[model samples]
Target: MRWTVLPLLVLVPLGYVIISAQQSRESGESKQLEAAARHLTFGYYPSSLQQRIYQVPIPYGAAHVGYLETNSWSTSVLYVQFTTTAGGLDTFLAKVGTSRAALRSGSSEISRSQAREASWTFSGPGPWSGTSMHKNGDKPDHAISVDLHDPDAPTVYVVSTVNFRYGFRDS
Candidate 1:
């Protein structure tokens, strides 16, 4: 009886330790999965120039620019902002407009909209693209907006990995 009781005491503690270690390992894996999902799905503000999403090349007679990526809970955005003279902004607009018109004529997937300051919005989807123009009320530079979204993401029980970059042509 004495021998049996001693062995039971050791066995119980050993079992407890094994269970605790397994729980710790599973908890760690769960945390890692959550982080990867956030990196794939979540987006934050693009406050630094180093965190760029893509670049756009202006057609005709304008300068090409690089875009910074940003997101909210439900949307993804690519944006470029630069300081230039009013004449430069006009040139930028004209070039972008010409490009959008070409895209529209070429593809039935494209659609257009109007934004403030004579900006244009064009949207299409193979990998989803949106274009627009903007100016902050106080800022000295005009902004160009383009965004992309994945058509198939997040249905659960399956994982998808998406990698993105832009092909920008020199103007």
Candidate 2:
């Protein structure tokens, strides 16, 4: 009876280990998704706005080349949108593909190539209210703006009141 009980105890512990490993793998995947969403929003701006826009430093790499767009969707509200790409980050699609390929290729196989894309969005203070337009014309690659009245503060209050447009590439 002692010998039989020892085997059963080992099997139960092994089963728990397998289950915990699977859960850990899933949580990691979820974190990757959230990161992808945040990366897509960087340096995006909407078009046809009076405010001056400029590029912010990305730190340690070439700044992403793109446009910015800004528009007042409603009273006391503004919308900014832009699209840019950066290296050193994995996208959601790539993450999924890598996982699938790893399982299919087994332990010895490796991916030969990489992929990237431009993720776009409308991010700003105040309520976002408008139809996002995607037409070809003279527009900033990325767009972002501030709300004049959100009970927090005016968007232009903290910054200098001047129209400024410039670009910088980090090495």
Candidate 3:
């Protein structure tokens, strides 16, 4: 009886230690991924078009952008895109209307379209969510898209296309 009790105590402690280590490792990985996501989304934008094409005002801390992909070997990669509308659509709208009005109206339309697109794309096996939305009173609409996959396969793929109306207020 004495020997049995001593072995049980040792095994239980060992199991606890193993679990604690695993938890810490997972926590660290999560933090790293979050930082990666931020870096990816904040720097992505279409290079072909000049930034002036987007017209709405871009407020500080009011934008987000990123995407993630997983390959068949279970490896994953994340990409982020960022851009601001300074002279494009916003400038055009300011010619005819208040900046605030243009921003709010434009953002409302963009948000609606984004929500619809996200829903349609994720209706199947993949899952997605809109993590943030900032309506700049109708000048420029700011938003973020987040996606994830459980048991992601090596060949799993994900892509995000972001559209911005910069200079124009309506439309």
Pairs that collide in candidate 1 are: none
The regions of model 1 sitting more than 4 angstroms off are 38-171
TM-score of 2: 0.26
Predicted structure with the largest TM-score when compared to the true one: 3
Clashes of each: 0, 26, 35
Cα error, candidate 1, residue 10 (Å): 0.4
> 126 in model 2: Cα distance from truth in Å?
7.0
RMSD (Cα, Å) of model 1 = 17.2
Model 3: per-residue Cα lDDT at residue 26: 100
Q: What TM-score does candidate 3 get on C-alpha atoms?
A: 0.28
Q: Give the per-residue lDDT of model 2 (tens digit) for 20-89.
A: 9999999999556534442233343222233333222222232332322222322111222222232211
TM-score comparison, 1 vs 3, better candidate: 3
lDDT per residue as tens, model 3, 1-171: 999999999999999999999999999996576444422333333222212222322323323433332222322222223222343223423432334333321112224443443332334343433322333423323333322233121011112222343432445
Over 4 Å off, model 3: 38-103, 107-171
Local error of candidate 2 at residue 64 (angstroms): 27
| Order of quality (lDDT) | 3, 1, 2
Instruction: Put the candidates in TM-score order, highest first.
Output: 3, 2, 1
